[model samples]
Target: MTKETIQKTNPDKIDSILSDYILHDKLHQAVMISAPWGTGKTWYIQKKFIPSFESQHKKTWGVIYVSLFGITNFKELDDIIYHQFLDFYLSKSIHKKIPSKAIRFGETALSIVFANKLGLSSEDEMNKALKLIPQPDHIVYILDDIERSGLNLGELFGYVNNLCEHENSRVILVANESQILGRFNDTHKDKDKNNSVNTENIVTDEEKRIEAYYSAKEKTVGLTIKFQAAPDEVFEQVLNKVVDKREVQNLIRQEKNFILDLFTCSSNNDTETILNLRVLAFIDVTIADLYDSVKQYLDVFGKDNSFNDCLPSMINTAKNKIILDMVRYTALECFKFKMGKNLDGQSFSYLGSSNHYIYFLHIFPFVQRYIKQRIMNQDAVANYLKIVLKEEMVNQRLTKSVFPILNEWWLMNDLKVEKAIEQLEREEIPEGVGPEYIRGMMITLITLRERGFSIPIQHFTDKIIKYLNSMDKISFNNSAFSIVSIFANKDFIDLYNRTMKPVYDYVSQRLLDASLVEYRFLIDLQWDEEFPIKCRNHIASFSSDRRFLSIVSAEKISDKLKNANPGEIWYFCKGIREVYNISNVSDFYRADYETVDLVCKVIRDLIQQYEKHSLNKVKTSNLKMLLNLLDQTREKME
Candidate 1:
């Protein structure tokens, strides 16, 4: 880059000096630019300096940029240089004269194309130029990744020197000096040829070895510029159009202490990588959502929105959750890109789009423990971080809050909506507000709204029953009912027809199961309008339970479920449906455990043969149902 332009870009102290040296017409020796990775050295030289140097310099006609990153030999290097020149000419639409000996290889399409660029308008001119090919002295060569090439360093240096000294072409070498030359060995201590060698001889030998190591570099390299790009300048250049700068800057200021501590006393290379990525975090929240700025809101905390507008979101793209999954995926990918392994030592790969769900929820808690929890309590998070990062289960339970549930789309399929509802029920409810029934009522209202039907609150259930009865393919069968079930409890009637009689029979049996005596009494008091007060008293008195449930003076069934766990409430809601053997488990007081097992096993076998749903599906659902039934015994819930 020109001195003025580069200075304006970064104001680095070295810009002017380097720009002046590059712009100078003197061509006594080659020049070298040395810098570590991510310093924008290559970018600045290629994008700015070369164009400026060629434009501003008097002697230079064209600049040739060649990266010897993986080139192994002189032949490979020659091919790259030639192709890059042709590309450069193709880009510029310019042609230069070439000597005859170079075109003597003959008249192939390749020769013609290259010969035409060499200013030979006809095949005769190309043949005439073929007998005496001369080096292009007007071209300046920029050889990058000098240390990465597999060619011998001393040999390569000598070649570069020959191009400058004999071919009269200007050369620039780009590399990291420290990376190319590691710490000097104690070769000074080793005697050369004999023990008679003195200290002065040893010193001279060491200097010669260091100089001769580069072979021609001592004489060929006239100027060596260390590329120390300014930090703020680099960030501004890289992130100017990528993100919302003002807002990210504020967030960064808030997190300045943490970021500073993280990279304090770190090596320059390590620090440089982190600085670039910290800039990335604000613009795009990485997998951990550590520095995510996008805010999220849920209909939680007994807010007005909870009842006024309740919609069961099956899939959530809530910004923070997306950031969490995104950052997690990115972190692992970064590791894999660098180290060839994920944090868990499994070599991960993306298969189309399955990666979106892979390890996301499983590792979210760990990410939270490390990146988030520490902000609240260092000690708590410290302990939590240890377990989670080690591939162990998290100490904290996976939160089942409404916000979290919204993002768990994998658990909300038509086959798994019941699990979603159950999980939602597991959240810590706000006091005195029964949101589930409100949710239920909202659901009913929304359905009615969609169907262009309306009913009073008291008449809603009756209307739903009437509507379902009006529809075909449903009825109440005999004592021995066909086993039927729906995936969601709320889908009880609206979702299925064949389940009516089987569900009713199961509910009646479970009510009389004797284990849930108080539960049965409460339901009778709540659901049956004509339920005799005398019968309710008899039922309540039938058990010496601590809580006496009544008919007219009955508490809402929801009140009893207020403190119930998700599993328990799930059981209370769908506890009877399990009798269909689709989601059955041996939690209730049944005839026998063996019989229940045998029944489930038979149903499972039938499912496997015909696989109506799936045996595995039944097993998974049954396990959930069993857990729900078990939790139902723990406490009353709403």
Candidate 2:
């Protein structure tokens, strides 16, 4: 027999129970023990009640310890108890009987054997059978972990009462009160003996029982023990246990101190304090994930030989530092390795890595400072100014300054420059900026030709032409309209047709449009003869204009050239160039190598067109200088 560790607040309480049983000859078939988890309810049954009762009496008692874990239905309960009884009565001999169809009936038959042997049988035949069997003075049934049995209190208590009616059994049901009481009330609602006790009655009776138990044990017991953990108690215990472990002690100490300070400074009471303490406990567990990797490293590589092995050097390195700072560099490297993102803005690879060293290094210093400040001063108010400063200095610098330079030098340089430029030209501006804002914008515009609106090109050109006409500038070469046209091809062609056609029609309507300069020039113009004569007349008129001549002489015309609204004449000139450039005829076709030769011809034509007939002789020198400049530009472009 072993002594049970039943907790009694008062020594007189146990004495009263012994007096009731011995002096008054009082007997109880069932007793319910209640307490919270880790509150020693099972300890009381096994260490105090069972051993003491067996030692005090001369008669033998059978003790059954049943754990009701996972006992879902009545069948499970019956099976568990039956198995427990078998173990308890291992020293006793009993007749073996095979079960038939009904399990419940079979269990009832087995229970009768113990009752009959105890002289509890009512029938004469059963009583004769009971006389033949050895009698046990008492049966001590200990149900431990009864909360897992899923039995309602009413059903459980009712079962105990029935067992008591049949056998000389003392039932001890040990369970955590918090897990059982709420469930019991929700499931069972009977007024008769079937109900264990009313909720209010149960509370009052439990208090009285607790009071009696404590009073009986008052003299012998040194002190009543409470197993529930208080916030401060748990904090001190965990901190003491972890602060010297070498591997994780530093981090755990910091976190523990943080939690303690939080509780000390908080206006809330015990419950809220415990909740916050639990949160800090969770953070400690997360920090341990980092520490575990460091431990593994040290274990694989001997600690003495690991990371700056020389004691003097290590001490020098750690000057003006806390213990947590010892592993700060390692932690940071681990975080980065595990959590860094690639240029594609994806995190899959980093998160999948075994070590998150870099991320740890980046975050640990701030976390360390936070813990140190909180613990040293019990600071309830957090300073966000540091966070703001870090965001501006560290994060912003890394993103804006470092990332762009690195991306351009290392990644973008590998891409085709021309292709990249084309991609940019085609890119669309997204509603909001994307992850690769510049690159994605360029690619999107290249894919979709239209800009902000997805309307047809003709509509966009019409809008631009209307805007160009409204501008104040009237000079054809310098107008904002010409710049707009050169930038926008659709607008250039539309405006060119509007401006050039009237000039050609006015000349063609009169016979004066004819001259050897026009007819012999037409043959020399070597226009793609396939075009209608009216189109050729338009081209000639456009070529004859001083503004158009000036633009041709410049070689590099401003974007404004496209916005001139040169009417039919300008469109005719563009059509003639495109047709002749692509044509197969020797005189009409221009070779790629001769583009400079053709550009020189266009400059000479522009000088002839722009110089007034009276000023032509004097402007010849200026024209020769201009031609020389064109020759230089052509050589450079080649």
Candidate 3:
């Protein structure tokens, strides 16, 4: 029998087990060590447990370490165990060719010989091998990350039981119990109850199986040791190594209390803390991905638009950034909670219940502070917020309609809400939204537009009307409302109309030219009528000068008409069809074929001229059809 020394940070437990094995003349072969990841499981085993056992037992006791990761099935399990056994027996300096089967057979035979050689000869060599060596005899095997191994847990337990019962050998399985318990429970439930007769029989079977395993192998004990996160004292020791300042260490200690509060308030169990840390690590990876994506976008698009502009260019872009940031913030908060710190005490600030408000508030303050600091110090803080709020009124209108949706999604997950409220409290802000709140309004608007929401202009215009009506009820002094109103005033509205008119005219002309103007577009236009009319009459009357058209077409009307098509010549002409369908332009639809043909000819000619240089690689069929349609209309004009 082998006498092993137990060297561990927590050596009392180890000594107790060793004492048990020595007094009973048996090896405690099967043991399960459970702990979470990053808990020093591997360090304890490699540095202390294995060395202490090997040093004390010497020639009698052998130690083997096996990692059970990437072994998803039972077949891999056999190969892994066999390989570990072989590696343990073969000297590190001896790199000679040794087949796995030879190693397996050698382990069995060598144990028998070694038992006899050690003066433990009793009955047969194999029987002697089964007996523990020296006083308290045991061999130790260390299994790491057993849960991640993807092995059949029940089958693994069965094998271990066999080794303990048959050979008087001990087996140790180390894993994160939180990760493995579900799988272990499921696997155990699938076992056939009737296979073992009774509970006592089952226990006896396991013991016998273990004994038989050791009889063939040698006298070995498995010690399973679970390492947990260090206590406050140990954590302080670790922190002292990482951080130099005593003040920072004290701050960390104080913050740990806040973190503990977050954990206790939000997490369902201790396992959640581990999961949260893993998630935070993932979020760090995602932040890197987002930064790379922004870098690439800037590289391709030029530095004229800053990183923040990438969000507001499209709804999709904005949504992606918001979602990514939210996830990242949540993960970061989770990490803080796990580490026993509050995120509110960190860099994050919570806005009121409105997500849109939060989104703008979070980003705007950073932008404002950055700009202020840079301007004051001549530093190079990029003005991204300037780009986002390039036209303040338009931005305000967009934000007011969109912020509710973000707030709704923010509150979807209970954990998110709890964390958000805690963060808000830290920020000294009110907790959640009030009643009668419009949830996900912006998301609805964006989705509607993407799904062929023909009336974004009208939808936005109507929302403006409602907003204006609600002005009396809404307190403009509120930070969120104040920020929004700053961008939605008359001058801002005028600028937005001026900036957007060209896009609208371009779309309208495409519709008229195609003879596809419809009622929906007209109705949508009605909502915009008040704004455009107000702008044109009071602020600026936009001239429908042909000079702007000249940039689109340089040739004569006749020359342009000569190159028209029958079906569709312009991409914008297709837009006309959609506009007409959406707007239900009855008169335009019911116009005489000659008038329609003439309109088509004019529009087709204009589109062709505009696209002439651009359509160098256009399909031949499309160009020819466009030309034919133009020619037919010109004949009518003549």
Choose the strongest candidate by lDDT: 1
TM-score of each model, paired residue for residue: 0.38, 0.30, 0.37
On lDDT, the stronger of 1 and 2 is 1
Best by TM-score: 1
lDDT of 2 by residue, 1-638 (tens): 01223453322254345324332322434444554554334544565656766676524455667777766666677676555555334313335332321122113232564544444446664445333322422555667776667665455656665554455455555666456544553444445566464565432355554543333223222222222234554555444443445547555555343334333333223223322333344344445544543334323322323333334433332321222532443222222232231111111111111111111112233334333232211121122222322222222223222222322322334334334434333433222222223222222222233223232333333433343344443222211111111111344234333543433343333223233233343233432334335334544344333111222322432122222223322333444343232222232222222544565676476556656464444344444564574465445434
Better model by TM-score: candidate 1 vs candidate 3: 1
After aligning candidate 1 to the native by TM-score, how far in Å is the CA of 180 from where it should be?
A: 1.4
Error of 3 at 619 (Å): 36
Ranking of candidates on TM-score, top first: 1, 3, 2
- Distance from true position, residue 587, model 1, in Å? 42
Residues 359-472 of candidate 3: C-alpha lDDT, one tens digit per residue: 222232232222223221112212442333232323333432333333454345655444433332233111122111221233233333333433244444344334434433
Of candidate 2, the 10-residue stretch with the lowest lDDT total is 348-357
lDDT of 1 by residue, 129-167 (tens): 543322356557889987777765656777887877777
* Clash count, candidate 2: 60
